[model samples]
Target: MRRLLFIIIGLLSLVACKTDKTSVPQDFECFNQPHIYIKYKQPINGYTVKVMWLQNGEVGNALFCLEKQEVQYYYFTEKWTDKILYDKGNTYPNNTVIELDYTTKLKSEEYLSDDSPFFFSDVDFDGKEEFIINRYKSGSRESNAYDVYNVTPYGYFIQKTEAPFTELENGQCKFDSENKTITIYGSNGWNNIINKTYQLKDEKFELIK
Candidate 1:
């Protein structure tokens, strides 16, 4: 009876250990301002974690909590010194924290420099610059996927996911106003390079070959 009791207690301890290993953490900083972009890698409870978030007015916000293989220690402000780096491949099991409509006044302490991920450029040739954000990193060539939000005449942001915008992912773009074309060039993955040119007509993109 004594041996059997000890075995049962040991099994219960093992189960508790497993449960703790897979448990997710809950504490994190939340922002309410638009165009908020934060990126940092740090260690928490023996695991390496990467945090990244970007917010836009009306359109929404996105956050990523990635698990990295190696642990890195970073100073709070000094961590913002480097430009954003693209991921080499898919990350481990991770979490995402979303703050959809944080509508608070901008605080001075939460201010980020021009190293933000948001910008504006005219992709549809409408004589107005559209809102653009470097959404995610993809491919082995350090290319990025972009989110293009067209600015309406009434000052509203509408996301465009059709051609030209869809095909522009995982690459770098160059806009030519004279030729009325948008050129995207970058590596697709390990072997292939992407170089596609598209012309805008009637607010749509047509492949120019």
Candidate 2:
């Protein structure tokens, strides 16, 4: 009976200790105001986690959490730093290379001085995630901030070979990370709306009717 009880206890301990994946809500300094959301990893066992939410009376800007020293840390700022080496707004203390995706629109040659929110996923479905920069503005935010990127093996961010959307207006996007699909809805005109869906294929966005 003693040996049987010990075996049962060991099985229970394994059940309690197993962690395939974990989801948690983390608060970060967004737009100098506090924001919260259920941010999860794309593949759950993947290399990165992303946080994007609505702020400034709209949806844009994002926070990225990096795992280092057996603890998680986030990179967020009330202001955009002009540090040349600190591209993508993620500046860590030990100069660790946190993988950041750069999209075609927000490439290294382009200069966007304003603070931005971002979206990340394996939009290309190449087993790697990409990023899109979101903008905040006074009167309204335009839909032109849909720059996307894929991460190079060397850790440099390169823009996507093709764009996800040909045009964009004021709107929000829903990313289906599981299926690798992106659906966007935007106000096209006074009363019309633009609804489009794109799937990742051959490293390009294939529009779905």
Candidate 3:
């Protein structure tokens, strides 16, 4: 009887652990993270290959990646910013190359799809296309949340802050150009397929029926 009791307790423990991983409250906010914006995209090889970066604000370091490898790092400060002396010895939009430290290269499985990094849509019906960027590595069962970015009607990027934006944990989202909404579909948990619709309100996404 003691052996049977031990086995039952073990099973119960596993179930509780799994519930912790899979459980998400109905009103939980998904994109509650700090705003990280892709600052630049420049081609290193051909059009198919390029370099890009994302920075938090005027404080955090900028993460630069070539292909799937993080090849450089930069801090967002006047000291470092002033060191960017020239725009390739030219002008703005051309890009100023800066010295950067090399970071570890990503393995083969670390790469996302070719077009996976960017999704463009006008979720607010403002006639301006908003870009949604994600770092979802291909073939991974997890790592399925969003890196939300919505550009302004003028030309500034803004982060979307709202609750229940899709299932948040496992929802794979797509922008519906026709309806001006973001449709996310995935499993809530335990083989339950969940679908959600969201529309932009005051620039952030809000859940809608």
Query: Largest TM-score belongs to which candidate?
Result: 1
Worst 10 residues of 3 by lDDT: 74-83
TM-score (C-alpha, index-matched) for candidate 3? 0.37
Superposition-based RMSD of candidate 1 using all C-alpha atoms, in angstroms: 17.6
What's each prediction's clash count?
0, 9, 0
Query: TM-score order of candidates, best first?
Result: 1, 2, 3
- Where is model 3 more than 4 Å wrong at Cα? 1-123, 138-140, 143-145, 152-156, 163-171, 199-206
Candidate 3: deviation at residue 49, Å? Answer: 12
Which tens-of-lDDT digit does each residue in 16-113 have in candidate 1? 33343354334412222222333343332223333332222212233322233442221111011112321222222222332222122133232111
CA displacement after TM-score superposition, residue 4 of candidate 3 (Å): 56
The models' CA-based lDDT, in order, is: 0.43, 0.41, 0.37
Candidate order, lDDT descending: 1, 2, 3
lDDT by residue (tens digit), candidate 2, 1-209: 43344345434333322322333225412222323332342323333454322232233233434343354434332212112223434333321233323232244322222333344545455765564444333212433344455555544345543545423222455556567677767656778977678877665677894
Instruction: Name the lDDT of candidate 3.
Output: 0.37
Instruction: State TM-scores per candidate.
Output: 0.43, 0.37, 0.37
- What's the lDDT of the predicted structure labeled candidate 2? 0.41
| Number of the predicted model whose lDDT against the real structure is largest | 1
Off by over 4 Å in 1: 1-115, 169-171, 186-194
